[model samples]
Every structure is written in structure tokens, then in C-alpha cells.
Target: MVRADARENRARILEVARQALAEDGGTSMNQIAQRAGVGPGTLYRNYPTREALVLAVYQLDLDRLIDAVPAYLESHPPVEALRGWTTELVDAMRRKHGLGDALSPGLHQSITERSYGPVIGAITRLLDAGKAAGAIRPDADPRDFLQLTGALWRAAALPEDRSQPMLDLILDGLTAGTGRRTP
Candidate 1:
């Protein structure tokens, strides 16, 4: 178990790192330590490398997103749950876009894998539930769904005013064939 002071310092460091990365486009151990009101040595003691710090911050956010899945599933219909989760995912990607601006190209891949794996799994489970409930089209593929959602997120990340509309269109497509057609 970590000591109280250690845990406090770790939380401080993470918060500082997150803020620094979000606002400044990059963060260093010294910057994080200074922002956290700790010395550089203390920062190194908690996170030995920049990569380690970045991964921890990324995973922290990803875990929060994954934890929300159960609550969303419980409170919303399968299709709405999926739609809500997709919106959350776009928000996450926007956060990642901020982080990616701070991280090296190589580190970005690692962060993406660590963050997106569980997210994709949760989405797959949600899609499967929707499918079983006859809310999602029978021909839907979870991987394809994820890919399309990723594309939508990428489009949303663009500096345009149409992202939400585009997202709505995509969500409509996902549920298109699952319901009765009207004249």
C-alpha cells in the first residue's frame, strides 16, 4: 500500500500533469513537479519517465470512461446507451487530441492502445446487447461499428460546425434497418 503522503503527491502530480498537458501542449517532470508544488526528484520518484506519466494519465481517463458503461447501460435503452457512449467516446478522443499534441508520435500509439482497447470492448458489448434486443440491425458488425465511430470522432475533431450533425447522421445509419419503414 502507498503511504498517505505518497498517494497525495501522486495525485497532485497527475493533476498537474493533466493541466500542463492540456494547456501547454507538453509537460516535463520539472514542470509537473513545479506545478504540483513538489520537487523534480519527487516527480521522478512517482513517475520515473515522461512515458510512464503519460500512460498513467491516459489510463486514468480511460478507466473512468469504461466504468461509466454499466451505469449507461442500466439507465438507457440499448440504442440510446450506444449513442450516448459514442458521444462520450468523441469527447474522449478530443481529450486525446489534446494529449497527442503534447506527446511524441511513438508515445501516441501506446496511449491509443491502452485507452481504446477497453473502450472498443465496451462498445462491442453494448452493440451486441442492442442487436440481441432487436434495436440494432442484424447485419451490424461491432468492429465496423467501431471503425465508423472512430471516423466520426476524427471528423468531429476537425474545426467545423457540422460534426454533431454528421454524428447524428451516422447514428441514424446504425439504426436504419432495425425498425419498420413508414410511407
Candidate 2:
């Protein structure tokens, strides 16, 4: 088990690394350690390598997103919850792409395996809720929704303003005949 101080240092390191990665998409262990206010030795003891550190950061981000589904559902109507979550998911995909080129192939594979299921489940829940609430077409498939989102994220070339229109299109397609008009 990790001691309290070690856990704190690890959290601090991840926090610093996440910001550095967001700002530049490239950062060194020494830079992370300095920014975290932890010594190099402490950072190494926690992460051992850049890939490990990055993987940890990615996992933490995914966990927060996956875990927020329930709260989003409780706090917003089903369609609104799905809309907000999709926006967040798109941002996460952007960050993931920013870091993807830097991770080792093995780490990338591990990330895929670790991250896909929770994301799929969260999205499926939102889709299910939307359908049950009559905010989405009864036949709207979660797998199809996933595919559509994947395509959008992969496009990467779409202008920011245009992407929302595309998202609105998808939402409209999914909600047609269900009485949920795009807002």
C-alpha cells in the first residue's frame, strides 16, 4: 500500500504532468517533478518511465469521465446529459490525440484495452436513458452512436464551429420521430 505522502506526491505529479501535457503535449520527467514540487527520485519511484506516467494520467482522465455519467444523469434531463457528456468526450478525444503520438505502441494498446469498455458503458447508459425518456429514437443503437462519434473524432480536420453542427446533425438523426428537437 502506498503511504499518505507518497500518494500525495503521486497525485501532485499527475496534476503537473496533465497540465504540462495539455499546454505543450510534450514534457520531461524532470520538468514534471519540478512542477509538481517533488524531487526527481520521488517521481521516478512513482512512475518509473514516461509511458507509465502518461498512461496513469490518461487513465485518471477516463475514470473521471466514466464516473461522471451518473451525476450527469441525475442533474440533467437525459438528452441534455448526453449532450453535455458528448461535448466532454470530444474534448477528451482531442487531448487523447494530442498525447497519442508520444506514447509507446505497447502503452497505446494497453490504453485502448483499459479505456474502451468504461467509455462504451457510459455512452450506452446515456443512450439507453435517452431512449427510455423518449428523447431519442427507440431504435438508436449504442454501437452506431459510438461509431458515429469515432468518425467525428477521427475527422480532426473539421472546423470547431462546424463540428457542433455535425454533432447536432447526429443528435437530430438519433432523435428524429422521438420528439426531441435539436436546440
Candidate 3:
């Protein structure tokens, strides 16, 4: 376990880095350290390079997103929880774009797969719940849910309001005829 002070410093660095990357698309370690109110050495001890820092920030975001799933499931019916997750996911994708072309194709694939692992698991759970509740098509597969999520990701680049309609359409497709159409 890290010391409390060290943990605080790391958390501050990650918070500052996440905001900085969202605003600037690319941020320097010096800037992150300065904003984090930590020395360059401290920042380096926490994250040795820009890539390391950026990846950590993105992973943190994905982890947070995945962690929200259980709460959503508890408070919402499965289809609503799925919709909420998609909306949250779109926001995450938008924030993730702040990495600003820094990731190479290979790195993007690798990182995306890693990041999507827990998310896919959460989605599978949601899909299973939906099926059990008759809120989604019985035949809906996790891969199909991923394809739908990809559509939401692509649609997120559109004006903010435009994405929801598309999400609703996809959700409609997912939930129809299992007797859970939202009318």
C-alpha cells in the first residue's frame, strides 16, 4: 500500500492530468506536475512518461465507468440500465478523444481491448439481466451489444442531442419483440 501522502499526490496528478488532457488534447509532464502541485520527480515516480500517464488516466476513466454498472442495475430495470450505460459510455468516448491522436493503431487496439474487458463483462451481465426480465431479445449476443456500443461511440461525434436519438433507435432494436418496447 502507498503512503497516504503519496496516494494523495498520485490522485491529484491523475485528476489534473485528466482535465488537462481534456482541454489541451496533449499535455506535458511538466504542466501536469505543475498543475498537480507536485515536483517533476514526484510525477515521474508516479508515472514515468507521458504515455504512461495518459494511459493511466484513460484506464482510470474506464474503471470508473465499469464500476457504475452495478449501481445502475440496482436502481434501474435492465433496459433502462443498458440505456444509461450507453449514455455514460458516449460521454466517456468523448472525453477519451482528448488523447488526441496520440495512440497508434496498434496501441489503440491493445488499449481498447484492455479497457473494454470489464465493460464487456458488465454489458454481458446487463444483457443477461435484460433477457431474464424479457427486456431484450433472447438472441442478443455480447458481440452484438458491442456492435451497438460501437455505433454509439461513432454517433457521439455528432452534436450532443443527435446521439440520443440514435441510441434510442438502437435500444429499440435491442428491446423490441421480447415484449419490452418502451412505446
Candidate 4:
């Protein structure tokens, strides 16, 4: 069992690295360790490689996003909850894409592969809620929704950031024939 101090150190390091990498993807490990108030050895012991750190940060973000499904569903209507969730998801995706240079191609592929199932499960839960509430079409599929969300973050990378309106269109399509389109 990990001690409390070690857990705190790891959490602090991940938090610091998440913020630093958001501001500057090329930030060095020494810089992160300094900002995190941990020694270089501590940082290296926690994350043996820069790529490992980057992957952990991405995984942390995805885990939060996935865990948020239940809370979002409880707090908002299905379609609106989905909107809020998708917005955060797009932002996380953009950050991960920004850090693409920090990850090796193989590690990138591995992370995506490992993350896909959970992400789809999150989408499935959201879609299932909407379907049960009669807010989404019966034909809606989590895989297709995820595919379209890929376009969202990609379009978001462009100067225009048209992802919101694009998402509105997508969500509208999902709610079509269900009589749940917002007035």
C-alpha cells in the first residue's frame, strides 16, 4: 500500500504537470519538478520518462471526464448534459493533441487503444440515458457519436473553433424524430 505522502506527491506532480503542459507542451521535466516543489529524483521516480508523464496526464483527464457522466446526467437534461460533457471532452482532446509531440507514435497509439473502450462506455451511458428519457433517437449509437466528436476536436483546432455549432448540429441530429429538439 502506498503511503499518504507518496500519493500526495504523485497527485501534486500530476496536477502541476497538467497545468504546465497545458500552458506549454514543450516544458522540460526539470521545470515541472521545480514547479511541483519536488526534486528531480522524485519526479523521475514517479514518471520514468516524459512520455509516461504525458500519458498519465491524458489518462487522468479522461478518467475525470468518464466519471462525470453520472453527475452530469443527474444535474441536467440528457441533451444539455451531453453538451456540457462534450465541451469538456473537446477541450481535453485538444490538450492531448497539443501534447502529441511529447508522446512517441507507438505510445500514442497505445494510449488511444486503451482509452477507447472507456470513452465509448461513457458515451454509451450518456446516450442510454437520453434514449431512456426519450430525448434521443432509438437508432443512436455511441460509436457514431464518438466518431463525430473526433471531428469536433479537430475542427476546434482550426482558427475558427466551430466545434460548438458543429456539435449542436450533431446533437440535433441525435434528437431528431424524438421530439426533444430544444424550442
Candidate 5:
């Protein structure tokens, strides 16, 4: 077990790393250490590499996304809950693009698959609820919806400005036509 001070230092390092990565695309270890008021060695001791730090930041964001789901569902209609979650996901993807740009593609893929499971599960529950309530088509597969949303993020990450219109189009498709599930 880590000492209380060590745990505190680790938490502070992660927080500073996340802030730095968000504000500056390619966050340097020295910069993160400076922001956390820690020495470079301390940052390295806590997180051995830049990829580790990036993965930690992604996991932190994923935790927030997972925790928000139940609250969103309780407070909003099924369709509204799904929409709110999608919006949050888009914002997360924007942040992810910044962080992943600095890391290896393999590392990014591994981290995303590991950290995104809970997020996907939350979305699945929301989609299932929406379909059951007849707010969404019963034939709508949650996985397909998620894949489409991810595609939107990828499109938004493009050099061009396609996010808004693409998101609008996706939202329209999600709610297109009647709620009837074709036999």
C-alpha cells in the first residue's frame, strides 16, 4: 500500500497532467511535474511513461462518463438521457483527440478499449431503456448506435469542420420516422 502522502502526490500529478494535456495538446513530463509542484522524478515514479499518464487521464474521464449515466437517466426522459450522454461523449472524444495525438496509435487503441467498456455499457442501458419505452426503434442496436457515434467523433477529428453538421445528421437519423420497429 502507498503512504498517504504518496497517494496524495499521485492524485495531484494525475490532476495536473489532465489539466496540462487539456490545455496543451502534447503535455511534457517536465511541464506536468512543474504544474503539480513535484519534481520530474516524482512524476516518473508515479507514472513511468507519457502513455501511462495519458491512459490514466482517459480512465478518469471514462469514470466520470460512467457515473453520469444513472443521474442522467433519473433526471431526464429516455431520449433526453441518451442525447445528453451522446453530447458528453462528443466532448470526451474532443479531449481524447488532443491526448491521443501525442501517443502511439496502438497505445491509444488499447487504452480506449480498456477504458471505454463501462461507457459502452452505460450507453447500452440507456438505449435499451429508450427502446423499451418506445422512444427509440426497437430494432435499433445499441452497438450500432455506439459505433455511429464513434464514427461521428472520428469525422469531427478530421482537419475540416464537419462535427456539428455530422452530429445534427446523426441525431436526425436516430430519431427518424416513426417509433415503430419494423417486423
Candidate 6:
């Protein structure tokens, strides 16, 4: 069984690593250990390698996002909830991309492979809620939404952050009554 202190240490390390990496992806393991208030031995014990730690940090972020769906749905209307959630997802994707050359190709592949299914499931939940609320089109597919939004995060490096406005348009298209009409 993982002891309470061991779990706390691991959580603290993850939190510190997440912040440190976001601020600067080049942050070192020793630096993360120091910042986390844990010894290098403790840090290594929890995450045997820098790559493992980074992967853990990323997975934790993704899990946090997935876990947030219920709260977002409870707090906002369907469309608004989807908007807020997708906005955050875009930001997360931007940050993941921001890791850029720091992440090895294998790491990139690993992250993408691990993230896709859960992300789609989360989108499915959000879409289901919107459908249940009668706000989104019955024909809307989560995969299509995911494919479209893929471009939003890819555009993050642009001088102008035009994602939100573009997202607004996408949401409008997804709105129940807005499907194309007969000519």
C-alpha cells in the first residue's frame, strides 16, 4: 500500500513539475525536486526519470480536465459549458504543443495515443449533455467536433489568438436549429 506521505510527496512533485514545466519546459529534475520540497531521492523514488515525471504530469492534467466535465455541466448551460470546457481543452493542447522540441518524438506519440480515447469520451459526455438539454443538433458527432477543434489548438502559435471566435462559430454550427436548410 502506498503510504499517505508517499502519495502526498508524489502529488506535490506532480504539481510542482506541472508549474515548472509550463513556465519553462527545460526545468531540471533537481530543480523540480527542490521546488516540490522533496529530496531528489524522494522525487526519483516517485518518478524514476524526467520523462516519466513529465508524462505523469501531462496525464494528470488530462485526467483533471476529464474529471471536470460534471462540474462544468452543473455550473453552466450546455452550450456555455461546452464552450468553457473546449476553451480550456484548447489551452491545454496549446501548452502541450508549447512543449515542442522538448518532448521527444516517442513522447509525442505516446501522449497522443494515450490522450485520444479519453478526450473523445469526455467530448462524448459533453455532447450527450448538450443533446439531452436539447441545445445541440441530433446529428452532431463528437469525432467531427474533435477533428474541427484540432485546428484550433494548432493555431495557437499565431500572433492573434483567434481560436475562441472560431470556436464560437463551431458552437453555432452545432446548435440544434442551425443546420442547413433546403434551398
Which numbered prediction scores highest in lDDT against the true structure?
Answer: 4
Please rank every candidate by TM-score, starting with the best: 4, 6, 3, 2, 1, 5
Error of 2 at 98 (Å): 0.4
Q: Write one digit per residue (lDDT tens) for candidate 2, span 79-137.
A: 88988888778777777777755577898788888987888899999989998888888
Candidate scoring better on TM-score of 3 and 4: 4
Give stretches of model 6 more than 4 Å off. 176-183
lDDT of each: 0.78, 0.82, 0.82, 0.91, 0.80, 0.88
Residue pairs clashing in model 2 are none
User: In model 5, where do residues sit more than 4 Å from their true spots?
Assistant: 1-4, 154-165, 177-183
* Per-residue C-alpha lDDT of model 5 across residues 116-172, encoded as one tens digit per residue: 667778878887888777777666666777777777777767899576677677666
Error of 5 at 114 (Å): 1.1
> Which is the leading candidate under TM-score?
4
What overall lDDT, based on C-alpha atoms, would model 1 receive against the true structure?
Answer: 0.78
Q: Considering summed lDDT, which 10 consecutive residues are worst modelled in model 5?
A: 173-182
* Candidate 4 residue lDDT tens string, 2-61: 999999999999999999988888899999999999999999999999988998998999
lDDT comparing candidate 5 with the true structure: 0.80
- Sum up the clashes in candidate 2: 0
Quote model 1's TM-score.
0.85
